[model samples]
Target: MAKGMMIVDGQRVNFDGEKNVLSVIRKAGIEMPTFCYYSDLSVYGACRMCVVEDEKTGKIDASCSMEPRDGMRISTNSARLLKHRRVILELLLASHNCNCTTCEKSGHCRLQELAQQFGVRRIRFPDTREHYEIDSSSPAVLRDPNKCILCGDCVRVCEEMQGMGILNFAYRGSNLQVMPAFDRKLAETKCVSCGQCAAVCTTGAITVKNQIGEAWRAIHDPSKRVVIQIAPAVRVAVGEAFGFPAGENVLDRLVTALKLMGVDEVYDTTFGADFTTIAESEEFLERLKNGGPFPMFTSCCPAWVKYLENENPKYLKNISTCKSPMEMVGAIFRDKYAAKDAVDGRTTYHIAIMPCTAKKMEAARPEFIHDGRPDVDLVLTTHEVIDMMQETGIQLGELELESPDLPFGLGSGAAVIYGTSGGVAEAVVRHCLPDKSKNALREISILGLRGDAPIKEASVTIGDTELKLAVVNGLANAKKLLKEIDEGKKFYHLIEVMTCQGGCVGGAGQPYGLKKSKEKRGDGLHLSDNAAMFKRAERNPVVAQMMAEYGEERCHELLHVSYTNK
Candidate 1:
């Protein structure tokens, strides 16, 4: 961290002046209004609301993209700045239909905040009222270009965060809107449906295919059993729904809240991940022994799996045959556990709490069907969970500890961290090694990936063998890895790919509000992982307990699942 002397509002302050102005300004308790400026991604400086006048340069520049220098005097709130800001926003409003009263993001829109900040009273530019159509074609997300500010935030996040690069600027000028490859609808493209775009949109241009109301309907319906399975990455970010900051553990409260919402049974997907590791590790060793695919890719991320299938089908054989933890857990609860427990019932409604939107597509995949019913019945984003709680009058502080149901209930720390990038591989390495020693597990922390750049790569030795692994957190980066693998440039024994950046921490399901940027809740998951007693897949007492009661034969035959190129 380098030092720089910056004068803001006539007060001199010491700033870590190496990077952009947004970094230093926020550090000094000053809010620099912005769009097109995300800390997790690069500063495009497109929305000039962060414009500040420099004493030395005599030119106003976007604080987000500017490099602070020593002795630089910056004016963040001058009349000149406001005028320019309002003009930029007003011109923006002309081509866009905000419909704030009805918009889901009305209270939390960055564009709306900027409008009020600049005191833009009237639409100076014609409404053109020239309407643009909304594309609700994607099962996971909907794109309303009519409300898009064209800040390129979605495009940038898709490119810099997820690395999917799906939302590229198409055509030119007035006709230029974010369009996917070949201008196809999102459903038809290599979109992956991670919904990072929806998370980044300042307006309600993009949103998850909301199913909270549907969930509520089921919860109230006596006929349907609304069983909820919480994903590992969800524990890290779901706290934000209840006003908990990033990194704060609210599992107890969350569980209580879900129980209040009328879920018949609340389970953690970590158990699924735990089961997944058992199956995957066994499969990994099998691959090594039989000399199968050199790289056994993790199939836990449906988005990544879809990318491989659609973009690089040649390497399909390299993918691990294990089903995603969510689906795997779903299959057991619906088919295996139902039969074993002798719970003769009608159609089972299984709902999964996930950090990625692509999961909706994954759940809908006809291939996921097991014994006539789909493995996963429904998928809800993190944001949707918060809505469900609010709708059901579930208070955050009043939540109590309600134990998750048995059979596929218990999970280890290894299972919890699967929400984060590199977590799955780390869990596999910890439990999958031939000699699962505590010393080896304690000494190694396989968490890789760096600096919000999306993908991370690292290697470690397991017993007599050194294992090479890659974790692609961003969807765009997943594309890059698939390309690298297809091109025969990079090689690894295993790869874990999550569709969202920062793993599930930056998931589309997380809460959102105005104020330019939202305080992230990422710690809840990490803290839960660190404090959990069981941390390995091989030795999770709950999974072991289940196996003992049901027999290893039963666990292997039903608890685990398989995948293919299709």
Candidate 2:
């Protein structure tokens, strides 16, 4: 597309390769209100909040669906456009469940924000919509049909971005609603519990299930020892709820807040990520020696694991048996605390604070439970932890920095970067390489592993052979790659697949953000990696000591797991 000029609200705006007028208008510094206009998704044009009027002819249309051309003139904030937006809001509110104060997405809901911005003080129509029962069948996500505005954001994200058409519009005309086929519960379908639907939902219609109450009860129990592990991505993204910059690392402050809130001990999940990197690298090397299962897929992401079990079970043997970092640490803590319980007479309640909603589902997997007790007692999202901090009257920004607990808290730089896409592959490469010098680490970092691209491919020479590697984020991209691999069009020695775009940094349970914010979060992880004392997982002394203490057989029993097809 050629560069063009247009007038948005009387200001001349230049557009170069912008897809829609809304992009050009936003580029012109105009804040256009929208409900269903997501940059990464297809244009629905269902919500007329971004309607603009043509200056030459008194006609109005959605800016998202219209392409910008040379010599185009439009009024974005005319009285007519405002009235149109207000009317649309009013109609939406008429049927919507308006209990904003009790909603999970209260302060962050787009519908509530736009309602106040457009002065939608009242609804003119009757609430004739039927009250639907809330669906809490999924362990990760909650669905409330009453609060839906029929924006189709969730539908498109699940289909286009995730390659999972678990959600779609049903019925006709005024009775249309988004739901699974035949209105099946999310868990009953092939839903991977990624929570991408909840992430894109503009209202409280869909949300992460609240586990804050469960977390609080465990914290308040004097008979229990509450130990929490914060995932690598949580540190960078959790601060967003408390007015911190998008990519700011608030781990130290978060550690202080968790301790102040009565947590017995807080550790970094990266410590476990180090173990994963080492174990996975060993597994890859063994497979390379055997010369079979050509590409061993990573098993860190629960959503990706579930997708394989549900949709592509034939390739289950190719997935590495290494437990996820969360589960690996949880199992170690469970064993550690079981001994402490025998001596101290206090039950240990292990909690995992993670950026992925699927972690909640992952924790509840049957394999992670032993003797009727779960390894991780509870799983909380980044948002839930922020909410808990706010409820306890602890402001993250106001809190002073404090170090994480020793031993299990210290993680290598390779482990810290596990929060983003390709970080796992890069970390494993760092472990595989014989050279441990800074230059070798720098060379490994530039292996096309770090970026916002959905799928990244690279190669590295190890010993006598060059190993082909691929890192993919987003299930849709992974699905495409899988198809190519199945057709013999693509081959790799090792593959890393993260179900969410940009890896856990762009997880649905993190602060609701698009591509740019996710990039900032990824950058924060890299910065932390750059400042670490050790660049490779194999260099982490704590991990090395733990491996020695646990021994080979015990380590294999605890750190590895096999999945059953659902």
Candidate 3:
């Protein structure tokens, strides 16, 4: 009942309503090492690295799970605590496959960093671990159990955040390992390839599938005309990999780098977003007019789309049929854009640089291919784009910024904001609303359908009807919304769902440990949206020209695709 205060290392610190002693210590600007602790997930208290000495009680407690009480005295880093941490790291390393030199997470592995920090020079225990085969069955993610420390971050994130318990602890004690149910391969499970597991994993236990070699192969082929499109989120987050601050836009520099890497032309996915918006807005308007399937879910997020198919098949009819911006651009490049530029589509290698790992799976979908050739030949994550740029030996900061190529390069403000959670709903209202007045699109923002909230709702007047819209991020949030919709407790004319928390900006393939990166990256998109020449997708001259040239029927043929019920 009294004001909670803690003495951390002789300094009087206020708990400030933090749930645990670890939170209080962290809030006081003291670094307490942790392995199984994630701010968003439930505390396991399995990692003893955060064990702190309670001077008042003369007891050691895992700070992550310990309650901060009034006048509690805590020693964060004592002699005994350091020795215990060192021993814990040593024991974890004894069985860990120490292939840091070749490990995918070599530079960013938390276990390796903690071991180095704790001065773990040698392991007293013998290396008795057996060979565990890598699980690279999923096209978007790879699982290497040898690198796992049983911290349970991946298992917790997959189950808690994604609502898909694809990864879990299996077996018992020394023989225990995290795996899919029945220890089946990841590809054989209900996993939707969102890659949140890889994003949360502290070690190389999980990682995005490395396709840098495949990209290089296409680049090296002289006969191939390589064209790369940069996604909306990539421009803001990719700069972080090069020591730049989060949400730093390096679009021009990115284009320059791709050009130097033998890319024939660099395009912006925002252009595709423009087309997708036009098509999707039309679809939403049509559905609204029909008065059926009241809440049409946004299908731009491939992971969310796949989740609908796999888990909520009855709602398949509720999902928008329009392909994502990535696929829309890929379809255009493979069918019409290449022909307009006098390049054979067959010889052109279309690569999409994206934020989400699920995009890799999306690009490989048979529905998006024609004549056995994928519309998008390769998919590269934000990290992959940075790695490829680094390999070129070009300093991104030193290079001059270059604009994207014409026709497929220009986009509206509505298109660029598609990178974040509520962005799709905002773009739809901006573009689809019948009113074209300058102040009409501004109403969407005034309705407060933007920000970092897990869920957002707004009402807009279209013609004589008022439509309610909801935007939700994180699959867990989406699951809760779906339950409400199914039970008739909540209803909306439109709902936008992004699988990852904070949408694509917080994707699994983003740079590691960039805290608050999603909020910052999303801010960049909003700034771009405000500064864009045209606020609505319909105002884009390029989109108008495309519509005039392709007509409504053909435009749908190129930018739209149907989903399959699993």
**Best-fitting candidate, measured by TM-score?**
2
In order of TM-score, best first, we have: 2, 3, 1
| 354 Cα displacement, candidate 3 (Å) | 0.3
For model 1, where is the 10-residue window of minimal lDDT? 513-522
Model 2 C-alpha lDDT per residue in residues 1-566, reported as the tens digit of each score:
74889998889999999999999999999889988999988999988889899999989999999989899999999898888989888889999999999999999999999999988887888988988889999999999999999999999999999999999999998889889999899989999999999999999999999999999999999999999899999999999988998889999999999999999999999999999999999999999899968789999999999999999999899999999999999889987777889999999999999999999999999999998998998999999998998898888889899988987898999998899999999999999988888899889989898897988999999999999999999899999999999999999999999999899999989998888999999999999999998888888899999999999999999999998888
Best by lDDT: 2
Worst 10 residues of 2 by lDDT: 1-10
Per residue, candidate 3 scores C-alpha lDDT tens digits across 1-566 of 22578899999987666889988898889989999999889999998889999897779989999888898999988899888999899999998999998998887899999988878888889999987999999989999999899999998988888889888898998999999998799899878999989988888999999999999999888878888888888888888877778887788888988988888888899988888887888888898778868789898888898888899888888888899999998988887655753645348889999998999999999999898999999999988888888877878888888999886888888888898878888888887777777777676777877876878888888888888889998888889988998799999999999988888888888886544878899998888888888888878898788779998788878888888787
TM per candidate comes to 0.90, 0.99, 0.97
Candidate 3 regions off by >4 Å? 1-3, 337-346
Model 1, residue 361: C-alpha shift (Å): 1.2
Q: How close is candidate 2 to the true structure, as a TM-score?
A: 0.99
- Candidate 3 lDDT score relative to the true structure: 0.87
Report RMSD (Å) for each prediction in the order shown. Answer: 3.3, 0.8, 1.6
